[model samples]
Target: MTFDPTLFLPDDLLERIRERAPIHDRENTFPEQDLAELRAAGYLSILVPTERGGAGLSLEQAAILQQRLATASPATALAINMHLVWTGVAKVFSDRGVPGLEFVQDGAVAGDVFAFGISEAGNDLVLFGSDTEATPQGDGAYSFTGTKIFTSLAPVWTKLGLHGLDTTSPDGPKLVFAFIDRTDAVTTSDDWDTLGMRATQSRTTRIDGAVAAAEHVVRRIDPGPGADPIIFGIFSVFELLLASVYTGVARRALDLAVQTAQKRTSKKTGLAYSQDPDIRWRIADMSLAYEALPPQIAALARDVDEQADHGALWFTLLSGTKHRAVTMAKHVVDQAVLTAGGGAYFSSNELSRLYRDVLAGMFHPSDPESAHSAAASALLGPLQG
Candidate 1:
């Protein structure tokens, strides 16, 4: 059966979300209402197994829904992406016969919001390493002590899925992946001011000996990137979903450009801007760039769903797709702003807001530099040394 995204995220619900986007952006706050409505709709559990009281959608289907959600509210989609990443990871684990993250899947079904707490300032190693300290409590529990930056869903996440270096283990410097609750030891800083994606309110988090119970301690693997299923799950889901959101941003920009071209009339030509040769060419160029990404995103997402072994090239393909989506989104928004003319320069204009929101794409993981390096390594092997 072909999965229909509209069944989950209908147009009316999306219109409501779209209406609230500007308000959240203007206030620089989290989209609480959007979260409530989406939670009510069971959107948070779309990746969990149907037997577990979820939509049981594949990663490919989730990507399509994410793109649709992003078209209505990019910030909402981006914030929700963090929660979905954990559930998606759980699905990945379950599908591969891994047993640790069943709690994550169940938590999502029970309405527990899981935040991705892996990002740390100055820790460019990302999943490969962690600056945080993981102190084992002897009985398999671990206490995390470090500050994590860009902790999306900071304001409301019920559990945090994070990584830290457990140096005290006899195993010798294993990266411990665990889930900790928001206790008194955990502090969420109110410092999420940014140029765009403001509605996310992705505040910084400070963890001072926040402990993950024994059952919540998921993976304890050696660092520096290997074929761990957890690593593959995180990287694939994160990169593909990030790409899907930005692809939706590009789609919205292209749609706005078309609407502008059809509505705005040219004084010189005495016809709609759509009839102008230059404007038509610009729209066509935007269309060309926009048309290429969804298929790539869909293909990679399906490959993940079917567990198609892309082997060592997985990183390159994932990162490159993300890079292309973000860059293409930025380009389409730039053209949309040009097409809409000076009116779009105003802050109230949706095009202007999109112009700001799309700038955030370059900063996500698998950034252009990292993507190019992975691609280069795939093609020409690693640099000597």
Candidate 2:
């Protein structure tokens, strides 16, 4: 992934999305229109490789476009997170790496989506969790019965990648990536209606007696790290992507305030609210925060592109960006409310819609507390011999 500064988001498509954002939010429907537009624009298959029949867009471009999407509707961007995450994993499995890696390479190239069943009811699904179960079954297949909470995009996924704990092994918990065909499993409880990301469709996914053969499962040559790096990496991606979404929401808030002020004038002063000094400064400050966010995240994307390894460099930049994004959310939109004044409080205004949407960023798993800890660990000098 190259760090190209000239990169910009698909503005026209995003503007159309912005127009329909209110309806999507109001009706609590998945951003079907937004997803269609993204798919039509070749965004749904972004992580898929060029040889495989997908865009294979660079990290930088993906980030730019995702952020743009967030500005229109963060929930829509979130719904696609699982798709993109699994797409990356599929590519890795297809690529030449680890022992017995030759398998799935062709399928990956051909394009297949996988949804990870990682988190259980009690497990830290937000962070990578160690939840797996396996028992040998007839015909070299095994039954997997595990409860996974917060399974985003599970409703729309066909391939199920269950991260299970293989208890048969004496070596602690052997984390295995089990692949199950969608036709084999059932969503015990598929009802998903949420408070914030109303349209994300993040339902509780269940796989009872789903059988996946040994060949379908792909474990690392050595089971390198304890957990799937992709899942852990998702937290990092969530931070950046959600941050962009939050920033976009804030941008919309500012836009709404400006538009509201333009249409209304002070009856007492005979002047438009936009012309008022107080209003000018508020808009100025809001714009300043919005301008500051994209560059900060763009810089982080560049750093990630340079450092492929999810080591110190990636951790530092990614966690730091999450922290910065949360701060920016509080600063930009909170103040934008003041700028919009009394009008924004009314449910009729777009500002009210953005007000709730922008706040969703703060509640993501990458809260300031955990992010700060990661940042501090990164800053701490490696212990000298």
- On TM-score, the leading prediction is 1
lDDT of 2 by residue, 1-385 (tens): 5543223336677678778766767776667677666666666666556775666665556667666676677677766666655554554434423333233333444444455566576554334445556655645466777777766655566667666655665563455566787765656365765545666666787777788877876552123323354544455555666666666566666676677678778888899988888888888887877788788777665544443565655655676676677677667777777876777787666666666666656656666766776677777864358
Q: Which stretches of candidate 1 lie over 4 Å from their true place?
A: none
Total clashes in model 2, counting residue pairs 3 or more apart in sequence or in different chains:
3
Q: Tell me the deviation in Å of residue 306 in model 2.
A: 3.1
Please provide, for model 1 over 1-385, each residue's C-alpha lDDT reduced to its tens digit, 9 standing for 90 to 100: 8788899999999999999999999999899999999999999999999989898999999999999999999999999999999999998898888899999989999999999999899888999999999999999999999999988888889999999999998886999999999899999999999999999888999999999999999999999989999999999999999999999998998999999999989888799999999999999999999999999999999998888999999999999999999999999999999999999999999998899999999988977889999999999999996
Model 2 regions lying over 4 Å from their true place? 1-12, 89-116, 125-127, 132-143, 188-191, 212-235, 308-310, 380-385
Against the true structure, candidate 1 has what lDDT? 0.94
Window of ten residues with lowest summed lDDT in model 2: 96-105
Estimate the TM-score for candidate 1. Answer: 0.99
Worst 10 residues of 1 by lDDT: 361-370
